[model samples]
Target: MSIQCPSCNSQRIITRDIARKLGGTTGAIAGGASGMAGAAGGARVGTLVGTIGGPLGMTLGGLAGAIIGGLVGSAAGGAAGAKLGEEIDNKVLDNFQCANCGHCFRQQD
Candidate 1:
């Protein structure tokens, strides 16, 4: 069930690390932005929730909100980043040339 190079039928295929790096970097950026947005929304909600507890309650609520928001955001970001990385590997990185034959081809899934 191993991937064979189409041109030379060689199994010495190597994955390109750069594709994962690029995909992960892009994913991190996207995740960070979404996380920030989540934090802002959470803070607003927390503020309202804390209203019942007074100023002290408000502070606690905001802190809790921020923590929860950050966790959720980070989880979502990581998942998205991993998916993007896989896509990059599949679509782009899989097209590496075989060292033995110097033939460029996509890896068989």
Candidate 2:
């Protein structure tokens, strides 16, 4: 029941920590960028809403906008990150060789 090398049917499989690390880093960057973009857009909309309520209304509207923006951005970024992580895992990290057959192939999940 252990993981087997698809090509060589070998059990001597190695894990790649670097690939995971790189994937996480990539995800974080994307998330941060999206969050910032969302905040900017939210702020602009909030400002318009606040004009009707005056200073206090503006402050609340902006705060609300930022929160909403951040949440939406985070979700979108997280999804993008997961997709990227999978691609990295399949294309880069999954590259392994079977000691018995010497077959080079991607690891199956």
Candidate 3:
């Protein structure tokens, strides 16, 4: 269902899941905070929250949420990223590997 990295056979690829988790958690916290604030100010908090939850909602919150999300995601994804890298590395190892040099390479016609 997914394409493996040409250099690595890893299926554990970086995907929207990572982004979504990072983005979602951040969006929720920030949106919730701002939504609460806007609600207090007589604006439609629900609308703002909805918007915050849409299309990288963190974007709406600006750099603060983004930086926070990135840091959190990076930390959370470190092990996951390594796992993905390992899986890709294994895949690359399996798919490539020059018969002569013991080096991993893509097959070419």
Each model's C-alpha lDDT? 0.74, 0.72, 0.45
Clashing pairs in 2: none
In the range 25-66, model 3's lDDT, one tens digit per residue, is 555555555544444433333335546577455344444444
* Best candidate according to TM-score: 1
lDDT of 1 by residue, 7-98 (tens): 77887766565666666666666776787788788887998899899999898888888777876777677677777777777777654667
User: How many angstroms is residue 21 displaced in model 3 relative to the true structure, after the best TM-score fit?
Assistant: 0.7
Number of the candidate with higher lDDT, 1 or 2: 1
**Strongest candidate by lDDT:** 1
Prediction 2 TM-score vs. true = 0.60
TM-score of predicted structure 3: 0.29
Task: Quote the lDDT for 23 in model 3.
Answer: 48
Candidate scoring better on lDDT of 2 and 3: 2
- Give the alpha carbon lDDT tens digit for every residue of 1-88 in model 2: 4657786667876644454556666666677678878888898799789879999998888888887888777666666776677677
Model 1 scores worst on lDDT over the 10 consecutive residues at 14-23
Question: Model 2 off-target regions past 4 Å?
Answer: 5-21, 95-105
Candidate 3 local lDDT, residue 76: 51
